[model samples]
Target: MTTKNLLVELFVEELPPKALKKLGDAFAGTLADQLKALGLAGADSVVTAYASPRRLAAHVTHVWLKAADKAVQQKLMPVTVGLDASGNATPALLKKLQALGADVSNPAAAVAALKRAPDGKAEALFYDSLVTGATLDTGLQKALEEAIAKLPIPKVMSYQLETDCELPGWSSVNFVRPAHGLVALHGSTVVPVKALGLTAGNSTQGHRFEAKVAKVVIKDADSYAATLQQDGAVIASFAERRAEIARQLAAAAAQVGNGVRPIEDDALLDEVTALVERPNVLVCEFEKQFLDVPQECLILTMKANQKYFPLLDATGKLTHQFLVVSNISPSDASAVIGGNERVVRPRLADAKFFFDQDRKKTLESRVEGLGKVVYHNKLGTQGERVERVRAIARAIAQQLGGEALAKAADTAARLAKTDLLTDMVGEFPELQGIMGGYYARHDGLGDEVANAIEDHYKPRFAGDDLPRNNVGLVVALADKLETLVGMFGIGNLPTGDKDPFALRRHALGVIRMLAEKDLPLDLNALLAGAVPAFGDKINDATPALAEFIYDRLAGSLREQGYSAQEVEAVLALQPQRLGDVTKRLAAVRAFAALPEAAALAAANKRISNILKKAGDVDAHVSDVLLKEQAEKDLYAALKSVVPQANAQFEAGDYTASLQTLAALRAPVDAFFDDVMVNAEELDLRLNRQGLLKSLHDAMNRVADLSRLAA
Candidate 1:
């Protein structure tokens, strides 16, 4: 079979920067996958995706001009139905064979050639045939249509194209953007394919202004990127363009000297890469007075509004000069730099004005305005939510550090939501908690209270840092707890992935703080404390909420490499103090490694089943009723081992506690082997049950050993 590399490109208007990467990957992946499925491409074929601001393209290696013919076997109806008792073909069988493109004129011969096989309880007839492979022209057209249909377009645009008629009829086309050109080449030959109401060709338009020619004619499939870069003056590969932009940014920053570097943000880099075809990094500067405003404000305005990369000094402080990735590289470059600087000055000035106007009124004054701002229709105003958070925070603080911490937490919680009313935060909701801290400090509040106000929303996502101080910790916990409980109470629990309130994130934040911080607080007690703040506004959802949190913890632990059995065993106890969960899991893991672990785990499972049927057996063994010597031996062993294990457990040595019980394995085996748990005498049976119950209780202090039975 002859084969050649294939190249396909779709050129259109500028694509959404954030969605370009996904679109490119999906386009290339789906096209290659469809070709492979059709047998036109082998499994080992390589696919390369190229995307720029105005195009998505793919180059696939070893794509055959026609798929290899395949032998196919298809099952037909039962043999009895296909042929009559006398072996004459029935009309149904002839119709089926006709539908399958088999010869139907001689039905008896066709039926005679059919293979017989057992399909379930009945014998079925099978037809074997050779299927001709699809040609590249038809296959490529289908693959291109499917790939375009499957693109992860953020939005679609509809437009009309001029028809090839002298009368000037227009044909409507719906696509991510208005289709300008479509290029499809199999090696050097143009594959006749049409998409988005445009026919495939060997040529495509490149960089609007910098292209040496308006249209760069792709000579061959292998030369797509080279031709675009050399003749069209556009870097075709997204990754190559991103690397070029990074190299240019680094080189430009080095020219400024003193270890200055461009701010590192991969998302920003990707967006900039998608915005320009020929990236030319230029250093631009705004007035130093803009730096007097918070660096976060200036940096955000420059990056978000202008798509500029702010330079950073050796100490990670933002510099006045920033870098811009321009589409065209001019020899002088002064106009580009000056134009970008002029564009960003007003954006920075607006941020500064908002910050100045916000600090004029104290956070305390803003607190009153939150009453008018609706937080949730069911939860009432932000003022009401603040009061609830304050109550919860005060309770947590007092439990953690008494009156001084309580006062600080309460003050912070009261002012935490006040930033929502500030002009700066109102304009940029991402800076809500941050602006509150700044304004709190401006209001002459102490560091303890101001820091707590800001850090209340700390650890916003996975791996984020927790609060820096005890007051901040209390406030953060209280804020998260209030959201979890209130939402859960109103039957707004997260279903599937539709957690509009981010309840799962809130639960994870709670778990991370409880486990990572290892605070002396009990999770159940903390949840109980949070629930009362809602009063009659919520139901008693603490049980369900606790289960959800534990489920999240289990998933997190498993992701951290703990086995399902290990996680199940530890979480089975529903330990109120989540801080000790890791220690218990470690102990369970250690115990599972013991030589006697499998046997003990099995015996524990047996004991649990026996005790459950025995109905409320007391832990007191009543040695007077011990008839079998094995039962007496086991009771004696428990009396000796339980004390040491209890002592270790009391000392917070869970591993030692579990390890100490390994000695009981032999006695337990003997008791179970020789003794009949349900004896003829009630007293003896109860005593045996009590002995097993006592054994069960000691073995599972750290985790439910029965869960490790398998």
Candidate 2:
């Protein structure tokens, strides 16, 4: 078979920057997958995706011009229905052959040619045929259409192409954007394909202004990127363009002294990359007085409003100078730098004004404004939510510390949502908690209270940092717990991926604090404490909420490399203190590696089944009822092992506790093998059950040993 490298491109208006990467990957993946499905591409085919502001393209290696022929075997019908009494072709058989595109002139010969095979209870007639392969033109057309239809387009535009020499009248088309050209090439030969009301061609438009010519002639699949870069002066690959922008930003930042560098944000870099064809990083500066505003406010306004990269000094302080990525690189770049500086001055000025006006009124006075802000319809105003959070934080703090910590947490929670009323936070909701902390400090609140207010919303997402101090930890916990319990109580539980309230994140936040921080707090008690704050607004959802938290915990633990069985073994007990979960899981892993683990686990499972059948056996063993030596030996083993295991468990040595039970393997196996648990005598059966129950209780102090059963 002969093969060639293939290329396809769609030239259009600028694509949505955030969705361009996904679109490019989907287009290339789907096209190559379709080609491979049709046998036009081999298993070894390599696909490379290229996406720019104005185009999406793919290059595939080892693609054949046409698929190879394949032999197909199709089942026709039961032999009894196709043949007559004489084993000759009947009218039905002739009609079936005709439908299959078989020559029916010699009906008898055609019937004989059909293969007979047993299918199920009846023998069926099978038709064997060689299917001709698909040509490059037809295959590419289908692939292109499918890929276009499956693009992850955020929005679609409908337009009409003007009448041309090939088409007589205007044709309506809908696409991601107003596509102007489509290029499909199999090596040097152009594959005839059409999509979005455009026909495949060897020519495509270059950069709107900087191209050497109006149109770029792509010679072949291999030369596509080179030709575009040389003639069009555009970076065709998204990654290459982003890398070039980074290089320029670094170089431009280096030109400025004092080790200043561009603030690192990949998302901003990608969006800027999608907005330009050729990047030219220029150093631009604003007035130094604008630095009076919070660096966060200034940095965010610059990046969000003007798409500029704010430079930072070695001490992580925002610098007066910033870098701008311009699409045009003029010989005299002072005009571009001056224009950017001029444009950003007003944005920075607005931020500074907001900050100055906001500080005039302390956060203590703004608490009244939150009463007008609605937090939720079922849950009352932000004012009411603040009270609930305050109460929960006080209770948590008192439990974790004493009077001083509780006072600080209460103050922080009270002022936390007050910042929502500030002009700075009102303009940028992302700065809510942060601004609150700054204002608290300005209001003469102690550092402890100020830090708590700022860190109350810590760990907004996975892998985020938790609150730094005990006061902060208490308030953060209270904030998350209130959200989880309140939402769940009102029956607003998360279903599938539709958690509009982010209850899942809140739950994980609570769990991370409890497990990672090793807080000496009971999860159930914490949830129970949060319930009273909602009063009658929420029902008692403690049980269901606890289950949801445990489910999330199990998943998180599994992601951390614990197997499902290991996690189940520890979580099955529903330990109240989540801080011990990791210790329990560690013990389970260590116990699983013991030579006696398998036998002990199986014995525990058998004991559980026996006790369950016996029904409510007391954990009291009578020596008089022990008739067999095996039963006596097992009881003695439990007496010795139970105390040692219990001592280790009390000392918080879960690994040692579980390991102590390994001594019972021999006696446990002997008891199950030699003792008759279900004896004819009722007293004997009850006594045996009691002995097993005591053994079961002892072995599972650290984890549910039965869960370790294979």
lDDT of each: 0.91, 0.91
Off by over 4 Å in 1: 165-168
> What would the per-residue lDDT of candidate 2 be over residues 1-710, giving only the tens digit for each residue?
88999999999998998889889889999999989998899999999998989999999999998899999998888889888888987788778889989999988789878999999889999999999999889998999889999999999888898767675888788888899899998998899898887889898888887899998999999999999999998898888999999999999889998899999999999899888888989999999999878899999999998999999999999999999999988899999889999999989989989988989999989889889999999999999999999999999889888898899889898998898898888789999898888888888997888888888898888889999889999999999999998999999988888999999899899999998899999888989999999989999899999999999999999999999999999999889889999999999999999999999998888888888787778998999999999999999998888898999999999999989989999998899889999999999988998998899899888889889989
In angstroms, the error of model 1 at 110 is 1.3
All candidates' TM-scores?
A: 0.98, 0.97
| Per-residue lDDT of candidate 1, residues 419-523 (tens digit) | 888888877888878888888888999788888888889888888888888888989999999999999888889888799999999999889888888888888
TM-score of decoy 2? 0.97
The 10 consecutive residues of candidate 1 with the worst lDDT sum are 614-623
**How many backbone clashes can be found in candidate 1?**
0
Counted clashes in each candidate structure? 0, 0
Worst 10 contiguous positions by lDDT, candidate 2: 162-171
Model 1 RMSD in Å is 1.4
